[model samples]
Target: MFATPAYAQAAGAAAPTGGMSFLIQMVPLIAIFVIFYFLLIRPQQQRMKKHRAMIDAARKGDQVVTGGGLVGKVTKVDDAFVEVEIAANVRVKVVKATLSDITPAGGARPAND
Candidate 1:
């Protein structure tokens, strides 16, 4: 009236899974990393590179928007600081890294555009 473990012996007869089995198990993790790299990390890196190029190209007379939402014309540009004139004879010094956007001197494009 009792079942024996003789059938359970068949369970242990299976061979151990090899390296290919381990690799298959890792496939989803690898794919996820690749997806994250392409979808998130890579784009952020490219955006930061483009933003760095733009900051390096900043010069005097360029209209700049700061991180704080202040808009002004760049009167002087230095390696680390920029003198921005927000109003007639009113200027403020800001760190170059704080610049968010830059419009060249001839950027008379319609504001509504």
Candidate 2:
């Protein structure tokens, strides 16, 4: 006759449901953005602001190290450019932004006032 068992249960159970499912789903996405800002964006902005302030404060006669690895004494400073003397009687004009560091006063020849 091929008759089966006495009773059978339902095929399968449904997924669990909750009232705040949408809000819970957004947590990981928001967390990733926060992590990215702290790990990447914040440091970069701070570095740029520091570099801008350093560039703005450049002046003549300060010993400066350039982005190109050249160290020179500043001979002149303009709004957007600087003149560096790398050797006696030899000088080069460079962008102010190219200077990476200005030697602190009293540690080297004072910057022209």
Query: Per-prediction TM-score, please?
Result: 0.81, 0.72
lDDT of 2 at 83: 93
Error of 2 at 13 (Å): 6.1
User: Where is the poorest 10-residue window by lDDT in model 2?
Assistant: 104-113
Q: For candidate 1, lDDT tens digit of each residue in 30-83? A: 999999999999999998998888888888999999999999999998889999
Query: Deviation in angstroms for 108 in model 2?
Result: 7.2
lDDT of 2 by residue, 6-112 (tens): 87777687755685787688899999999999999998999889779878877776788999998988888899899999999999998888888888544564444
Query: Candidate 2: where are CA atoms >4 Å away?
Result: 1-20, 108-113
lDDT of 1 at 59: 87
Evaluate model 2: give its TM-score: 0.72
lDDT of each: 0.89, 0.83
